[model samples]
Target: MPTIVVDVMPKAELLDPQGKAVAGALSRTGHAAISSVRIGKRFELTVDGPVDDELRASVQQIADEILSNSVIEDVVNIDFGDAEPAADASTEA
Candidate 1:
């Protein structure tokens, strides 16, 4: 089994009101040290099967196809978990 992590967010060119609201709160906290803040959603997917470049590519493709709309959306960051290789012992010595 392998785990896949995907992050989907609005493009920098797009307007993010929610992010703005959160950012505003930052200043209220008396933390002027922070100037800008962007909020986005994070998703974790667990897939059972082989963990290879092909699988990762497919996942990214899916994110672009259905998960996100490139028109006003952006998705380029993706992460994959460590998969344990199949175990087999050699009896021949």
Candidate 2:
């Protein structure tokens, strides 16, 4: 099975009230070193087979249409867990 991980977050320009409240609480609790926090959502999907281009497109569509709000939220990342890491081109030399 192949796993697709999607991370969704509010746009950087938008205010994050929950995150701000949490940060304030942390500071009050003596964790002042932490400057800020942004809350986000993560979705893990296990598909039947390898992640191909078609599947990738479908997943992107799903993320845009259902998993996230394009108005105020954005899909930060989509990761295919079964895919092999690309070789670092710089390391080839």
Candidate 3:
């Protein structure tokens, strides 16, 4: 099976109360080195067949139109999931 991953995050200009709360807790727990945190969402779609161009486009549509709110959220990333999901570009070779 193949999988697709979508990452959605609140628009940067808006405040993320949940993320702020988590950051506060982390700071209180001695994670002082971390200054801030922004929480986001992850969606994984497992498919039975090959992940081709058509499927990728479809998933992009789903991410932009269905998985996120245009008023406050943005679809920040898309992963074809050919391998283990990397948290960010820094983790990839």
1-93 per-residue lDDT for model 1 (tens digits):
667766677889877888888779989988798887777767788898887778866776777777777786666466666553212211112
Candidate 2 Cα misplacement greater than 4 A, ranges: 83-93
Candidate 1 residue pairs that clash:
none
Q: Which is the better candidate, 1 or 3, if ranked by lDDT?
A: 3
Candidate 2 lDDT by residue in tens digits, 18-45: 9999999999999989999999999998
What local lDDT does model 2 show for residue 48?
94
Once fitted onto the true fold, the runs of candidate 3 whose alpha carbons sit more than 4 angstroms away are 83-93
Name the 10 consecutive residues with the lowest summed lDDT in model 1.
84-93
What's the lDDT for all of these models?
0.69, 0.81, 0.81
TM-score of each prediction: 0.77, 0.84, 0.84
Select the stronger candidate by lDDT from 2 and 3.
Answer: 3
Residue-pair clashes per candidate: 0, 0, 0
What is candidate 3's lDDT per residue for 3-89, written digit by digit as tens? Answer: 787888898999999999999999999999999999999998898789877987777778777998978987777888867443452
